[model samples]
Target: MITSPDNDNNRDEPMVFIVIAKAYETEGGQPIDLHVMLTAPDDDTAVRLTLNALSEEGFLEADLDQIGMITGAPDEEPHASAYQGALEGEVAIIRFA
Candidate 1:
């Protein structure tokens, strides 16, 4: 994950990620729940961190909420590799695991 700004001019950009996990009963019954809500310096880092933490804790299934520019597109939805990279950093969630 690139911690600092992409450009020479340092600007602190923030990204948010939400993690949702299901609550279960003793016999493995189901009751869905929003497990955690976290904000990281970037979305890739946030999702990657959340997945790693949950996986280490032995959670099988979870949902990821990626907001802001992290969804790989902006308001206009431009089809450019550089544009996508500019919006979302070059961090892949699976790599953390």
Candidate 2:
């Protein structure tokens, strides 16, 4: 799990978010999905970061139109399972002081 820097003095730092997106491969292929946990000052920043990462990895902007959900920091219990199994990808969490 990648994590952003922590500044104890800053109380207004951005919270982390879990971004889940799914889109069909090509025009009729099977659906592809991604689960990423990232930190940003807000939802918009998180989405932008996710998009940039995806694009860097060859995912087109047109293919990302089918976002399933963008949720704020989830509780620990449910997220614990995400850490298990094979790792798909990882991103450092960003925190602003």
Candidate 3:
């Protein structure tokens, strides 16, 4: 669901990673859930990219809870949009505030 940074993969493919995170827009503000979707070769890269995206989105702090790979296209609203964005080399975040 996401594009690889180098545009290459060992098997000519990258994995879609969904990072579940609790993020704060401002210091001491209420946390919101961010489902960050991206593509990377490995989990490490996924986590790093997800964090970086969150930071760029103005999240001051983030608590990463889980990282999972999505093998199929999501059939819902935010997930569907996020997945589509990820495939286009964008870190798509579904925010639940």
Candidate 4:
């Protein structure tokens, strides 16, 4: 769970991001769609781990999105290293060494 180092210091750490998925059914009436939101760690490592766990459990469509480099404010606030890797050949592969 790639959490901020201050997770113990502060009780307001954001550990997970929400992902919304849905399924729809249509009959002679109005179409009804069922929506589900899943919460998982926002970092790459936890995302990969969760995906792998789901894959092992037979879930195939769940995947991760890459949001390249981010620009942060030039203040004294502490920051952490980001997940390293490129989205090679359309696959969001994260590498940690």
Which lDDT tens digits does candidate 1 get at residues 21-76?
Answer: 45332345454454343445665766667666655655565555434444333344
Inter-residue clash pairs, candidate 1: none
Q: Which window of ten consecutive residues has the lowest lDDT sum in model 2? A: 85-94
- Could you give candidate 2's per-residue lDDT for residues 4-60 as a string of tens digits? 767774645345456666533255565566665655566687678777766666555
Worst 10 residues of 4 by lDDT: 81-90
Clashes of 1: 0
Full candidate order by TM-score, most accurate first: 3, 2, 1, 4
In model 3, state the lDDT of residue 48. 92
Give candidate 4's TM-score.
Answer: 0.27
What's the TM-score of every candidate structure?
Answer: 0.37, 0.47, 0.85, 0.27
lDDT measured at residue 73 in model 1 versus the true structure, 0 to 100: 34
User: What residue runs in model 1 are displaced by over 4 Å at the alpha carbon?
Assistant: 1-17, 20-31, 65-97
Q: Candidate 3 lDDT, tens digit per residue, 1-97? A: 6675654445544578999999999999999988999988789999999889899989999999999999888999889988888888889999996
How high is the CA lDDT of each candidate model?
0.45, 0.50, 0.88, 0.31
The C-alpha stretches of model 2 lying farther than 4 A from their native spots are 1-14, 23-28, 61-97
Off by over 4 Å in 4: 1-14, 21-42, 63-97
Report residue 57 deviation for candidate 1 (angstroms): 2.4
Which sections of candidate 3 miss by over 4 Å? 1-12
RMSD of each: 11.9, 10.7, 6.8, 15.6
> Cα deviation of 30 in candidate 4 (Å)?
19
